[model samples]
Target chain A: MSIILDHVNYTYSSGTAYEIQALKDINIQIEDGQFIGIIGHTGSGKSTLIQHMNGLVKATSGAIYFNGQDIYDEDFDLRNLRTKVGLVFQYPEHQLFETTIFDDVSFGPKNQGLTKDEAGLRAFEALKMVGLDESLYYQSPFDLSGGQKRRVAIAGVLAMRPEMIILDEPTAGLDPKGRDEILDLISKMHDEKNITIVLVSHSMEDVAKYVQRIIVMNDGSVMFDDCPSEVFKHYKELEAAGLAAPQVTYLMHELKERGIDVDTEATTVEEAKRSILKALC
Target chain B: MLRDITLGQYYPADSVIHKLDPRVKLVGTLVYIVSLFLFKGPVGFLVITAFLALSIKLSKVPFLYMVKGLKAIMILMIITALFNLFLTPGETPIFTLGPLKMYPEGVKTAIFMLIRLSYLIVGTSVMTLTTTPNQLTDGLEKGLMPLSVIGVPVHAIAMMMSIALRFIPILIEETDLIMKAQMARGADFETGGIIKKAKNMVPLLVPLFVSAFRRADDLAMAMEARCYTGGKGRTKMKPLKYSGNDARAYLLTFVFLAVVIVLRIYNL
Candidate 1:
């Protein structure tokens, strides 16, 4: 249950005047059940890199393997592989096509060749997993609020019961409460289902609170792939890449620089508070 | 799949044709098309082809791109030629195949038809290759100003055309994204019969239509908020005026048209 990208490269608008090299040679392996957070500046190819995981975008000049099998091989069932590695794109609510929430959620499971009853059952359970009420299942997806629509989109993917899920900027354009609600829901999905999660984010604070492992991308290549604490240690490097460490991590580092015997690796505010209290004692 | 549409897509270039007034180009295209239909024999077709080549050169658009555009309508051109060659009644029999006879008149008509259609396409291509969509819309609004006296609402029509042109590339890009999103959810769009293929389009088409309407609604609201009130009493930031060069160009086109009309009248 691991994904490996070996020397992958991607170019946009290939063979045209507007051709752009979006990703250089990139190599990384994501182990099973790892809650990986990916961060990069806009246009740094973070989105492109994640898309390769589920065969959404084929690598221009390299290979991707799912659990040690080359996904691009002629015999490989890309459709089935996609179901095993669900991807919820940014503003995924815009992809909702069905009339009702129930229909939208059932779309994925139905495509997987499940019985109608089984698909319906999974759709209800997936909606429940995303904290959506069963009564709302019959309601028009267009009538739902922005946040609810977003959740329904995620539930649509979850209904397929993928082993891994990748989300690109899931919390973008949301209010603070909406952001927290989505982050909490994702964390719950990861913990309860033990599904591998790849979260592509621009916000340091959100990734800090939710992700266990961090993969920092810069200019279409992986700069760091480590636990959140290890990756945040290179705060200066992250800043140079047009990214920042989480606020709490920055504060902890500032305290450490001021001769406080506090752990500089604390990612969340609560963890930072504990570090501070330990240092005070 | 919608990305394959390349009609009226501007290729940015720095050339004299790109700098020409859109209205001049538009009128020139109209004259050129009229000349194409007026021309009868090979000599007139040669002259029109020469003019097309010169315009293509001035535009600095790749010749291969024009060929690519022609390729899209290749089947139509071939079918028209075949229809004329096989069906047209003529006196001079060139050959006989069992009961069917081929006539020199039919061959002449087929070749002439092909040349006429090619010229029409090339003339229009010159107009689109040189002008940006915005400039074209502006030209259209100005060109159709005379119709406004008949309550045509020319400005509104031009505005709609401009907005539609602007959103075409955007909508195509969005469709690509949605297709990928659904494909990642194991929705198979390929490897199906015609009916199954169309049924598979439900996921892609529904989302695309939904997003398009959402974008249109939002755009309308934004425009209304910014005091866009149906182009009433609107003044242009870049007002269009005919130059001396435009007059000269128009005169040249008129002379060309006169020559074509003479050829047609004399059956030359």
Candidate 2:
């Protein structure tokens, strides 16, 4: 399955004095099971763009197609589309309100009109997928740690068993250990379940390490859409867009500029380390 | 679209009304509203309307923008006018509708009530629109300072009001964000009965209350860290001081009130 956006444009408060063009004419294709990273500065339309894929925020102009069918078509089931394309928003923890973590995670499945038993089963599976312990399933979500609460929030979405899941700044405001735990959990899901993952993040290092493809957004437009290695090569343009390549990419560039024969395209620490050692040899 | 709500929203501009001491503006608003009820007939209403027009012009806020604020109370005004039109009895019949007879007195009462409601809203809105929240609360604290002798916690009350006003927009934005986040999770907020709609609000309200509490805690801690002891001896950077303009504002209000009183005394 593929999610294709056709010349999408979105403007907030269209007729008012505060109208803002959040997304320009954007066109992109997101294929099935492709782990993609979307990076951008604040107000650069990354959030607005991802919101379009699931039809949460309809485009002011243009169309979004899911598997060759327009999502905005009259007969299209928007609730069904939402079930198939899950979205975990920033500060996902705020959405958790059920008395127990189990019920909270199952809220989505229940809304999808599933039987109670089946919804609970999905909640159990999703909780396990997010690496949450079964013992904590009965606990009040508010009583959990900050990171645990976030996992419960994510499990609430994963319970729907969507073919694709988009997370917006999933690791923001988490401690270092919490951030790594979340990253690893999502990576494991991508690897094991083979689900398409659209990660909207601010960390270049994380994107370089995890995603197969990177999309750089600049002022409501896609500045670069390529693999991490190729995208990192345009370091100057990324900088002008208020973003930067991973630290390793910068280090490699510095080494090459100092007359050391090195691969400036190295995006991760391991790749840069290997390239520098190879040059020295 | 939810963010388009502009009721009681201040419009910033550099004008005499905006620059005046908020205490003066607050007192001025009180005098204007009192003067409205003191009017006996159209002559008195005309005088009060002229005074309101002068203040609105001095504020430099767009006339259309001021009128926009009246939309929130339009329904109330209509209901009151309807009650007056159909219920009031008089000898002079203006018209007839079904079993309800419209009389000259009924029509006059309806029009007067409409004018009173509209003028009340426009007059008070001008006060709120010209004064910043901080300044409004400061003025309120000082204006109610005499109540301290009655053991009233005037400072605390004003502080609470100011904080509430400041959080209105912040909480609104938070609610909008929370609602969208829940909506993305297959939560249907529309096309539901009252109970279902309220059930949907749980996902929104819980998070909003949680965040509001967290923010309050943070603000309290911040204030404590800054040694914000209660208003016992707290001094202001811009203390409320009456100037030549404030005196002139009071004199003008007295003249307007006296004219209305004279109109009533003479049965004008």
Q: Tell me the whole-model lDDT of each prediction, alpha carbons only.
A: 0.88, 0.90
Candidate 1 residue-wise lDDT at A14: 73
Write model 1 residue lDDT over B1-268, tens digit each, in one string.
4555556878778987787778888888888988887887767777777778888998898776666567678899999998888777888788877877778888889998888787677668778867989999999999999999999999999999999999989988998999999998778888789999999999999989999998999999999999999888889999888777778777877777787788788766
- Over 4 Å off, model 2: A11-19, A58-63, A67-76, B62-64, B89-104, B240-254, B264-268
How is the predicted docking of candidate 2 categorized under the CAPRI scheme?
medium
A129-157 in candidate 2: lDDT tens per residue?
99888889999999999999999998988
Enumerate the candidates' DockQ scores in order: 0.69, 0.55
Report the number of the highest-lDDT candidate. Answer: 2
Query: Which runs of model 1 end up more than 4 angstroms from their true locations?
Result: B91-119, B241-259, B262-268
lDDT of 1 by residue, A41-106 (tens): 999999988889998888899999999999999999889999999999999999898989999999
Tell me how many clashing residue pairs each candidate has. 0, 0
* Alpha carbon lDDT at B111, candidate 1: 91
